[model samples]
Target: GGILDVLDCTFEGNSTNLGRAIYNEQGATVNVLDCSFDSHHSSNNKKGAAIRNHGNMTIKNSTFSGNQGARSGGAIYSEGGAMAIELSSFSGNQALFGGAIYATVSPSTMTIEATTFVGNTAAQHGGAITQLFSNLEVSGSTFKRNIAQAEYGGAIGVFDSELVVSDNVFVANKDKTGA
Candidate 1:
């Protein structure tokens, strides 16, 4: 278990094999504020391109743009964790699943508020976000121009999860699997 707090940071063009930028393990608590992650990437495995959280994470007033993943979670992979994202934006990220965010594990939780996701793309599913067997709440968010090619959930995908969504705007999102 660990405690980390990062504030007012700018992470750009960072790359790794699996889960780069910040890797939060189980039982760890991390807080990120006023940060910007741009053009960060992950390769040679299916994981997070910018951050991977397996514990607890809170991100506020942040921006993620142009991040790429070899497989899943172009910006974040939150598995078996509690994550909260507020007043953040994700744009132009690409992945095979969850173009911007991927979260899983039952009993794990995630909340999003006042966020924006735009122009993210996935080759398979969840062009912006994906949650499987988790609890997720999203409100006051905007999703635009996200694309899921040959798949489903152009903006968000929830599979066997508990979800509450309200006051969100989705525009121009496309899932072109059978279209």
Candidate 2:
């Protein structure tokens, strides 16, 4: 029922089991601009290291680096609503799934544009991003030197979802499963 805005801030070295940097719950809207999430680490099998969004969220011109999610979504985990991440960068993030981002649940939409993902790693799958049970559109992005260990999709992984990808660049991304 309310709108929250975070602008031009740096969130660094935050530690938590969930949403080490930011948490946006249902019925809320969040807009993040020109922010940076760095070294936000989860000590356990947590949901998100940087952000956990269950509602509407928009992040632009931001950066995420050295974040660690023990479970999934090292940079962002979005569900249950509309999400947009644009003109951003993610680097050196680690997770079991979606080292950079994980978007799930039904009726949710995510748009990513002009972003960059580099040197991210996932233990199971999706070294850069994992989209499940939702709609995703990514354009003009870059994925470089990312790795997925023991599974597939070193750059982007989508399962049972709608995906539209155009004009993106993927370089030196690999999965340990040889897939």
Candidate 3:
């Protein structure tokens, strides 16, 4: 509803719709600082199994592990506007599409800094992050051991989108088409 800040919160083993741990709507400004989301699930919808954003979101020093999405964004999903993630980790998450993170619907801003994405999987595209009509800026991150079962982008995908990637490491990512 207004500017929000979450610090040192943990979300694990939850099952629900939208975001398993969080869902933001109506252009709220939110910050998740030093939070953890692990083993969450989305029982319904194609949104975040761990977190969802519909406004300005900033995530720093977080972790997401072993989450599941019924359709999309096993770890995180962002729509509407700008989302900034720094020093985060996304590991062992799964989804039908965009196993780790998904940004879609419109031209949103995504900034990832000093993050890690490891051992995530997607049935279709973007084992780490999927961007549809969005802009992404990633720096000082690592993507390792992620897999894409079909389609492209073991670490990320930009569909009708722009990307600014710098100082990021992509290692041990697997795809059927070899990334």
Candidate 4:
């Protein structure tokens, strides 16, 4: 098959570039189901230590934990196209920007529902999510204990973009913008 289906996979203890656990780019698509990405890191200017997307990706019933990005998108990053995430958990991830997730200039959109982001940190902005020139729809999500050390939007950043959030919880997040 031309599709990569990862079920009950565990990714942990990798370091180097961003998305130490997985990096999906150049219009590739990945479907992760009941998997775990944990305790990954990057060196300088690294991003998306757990998962990176420059394509169309989908994650369902997965967990991301303790990932770190030297630059941005500690747990996950998306650009260029659409990404769908559902019933997932992002916890204990850290980055210089978008500690948990980053969605940037894409031709399409991103959708996230029934997800949880907790104990993540961004040294600059958007402790949980940074949305730039893209479209995002989030429903039934929760963000807790996220931190932004420098700029703003502890939980989310909607910059020159369109975002729709419904039935979500933002709690105990630290940033200048206060999400």
**Cα lDDT of model 3 by residue, 39-82, tens digit:** 98887666788888888899999999999988888988888678
Model 1 root-mean-square deviation: 1.3
Query: Which parts of model 4 have CA positions greater than 4 angstroms off?
Result: 177-179
lDDT tens per residue, model 2, 20-128 = 7888988899999999999988866787899998999999999999999888798888887899989999999999999899999998899999999999998888989
Which one wins by lDDT: 3 or 4? 3
Task: Residues 1-179, candidate 1: write the lDDT tens digits.
Answer: 98999999999998766648999999999999999999988988768899999999999999999999888899999999999999999999999999999999977899999999999998888999989999999999999999888688999988899989999999999898532
Q: Model 3: runs farther than 4 Å from truth?
A: 17-19
| TM-score, predicted candidate 3 vs. hidden true structure | 0.95
Name the weakest run of 10 consecutive residues (lDDT summed) in model 3: 15-24
**Which candidate do you rate higher for TM-score, 1 or 4?**
1
Score candidate 4 by lDDT. Answer: 0.85
Clashes of each: 0, 0, 0, 4
lDDT of each: 0.92, 0.90, 0.87, 0.85
Name the runs in model 1 displaced over 4 angstroms: 177-179
Clashing pairs in 3: none
TM-score of structure candidate 1: 0.96
TM-score of each model, paired residue for residue? 0.96, 0.96, 0.95, 0.93
Ranking by lDDT: 1, 2, 3, 4
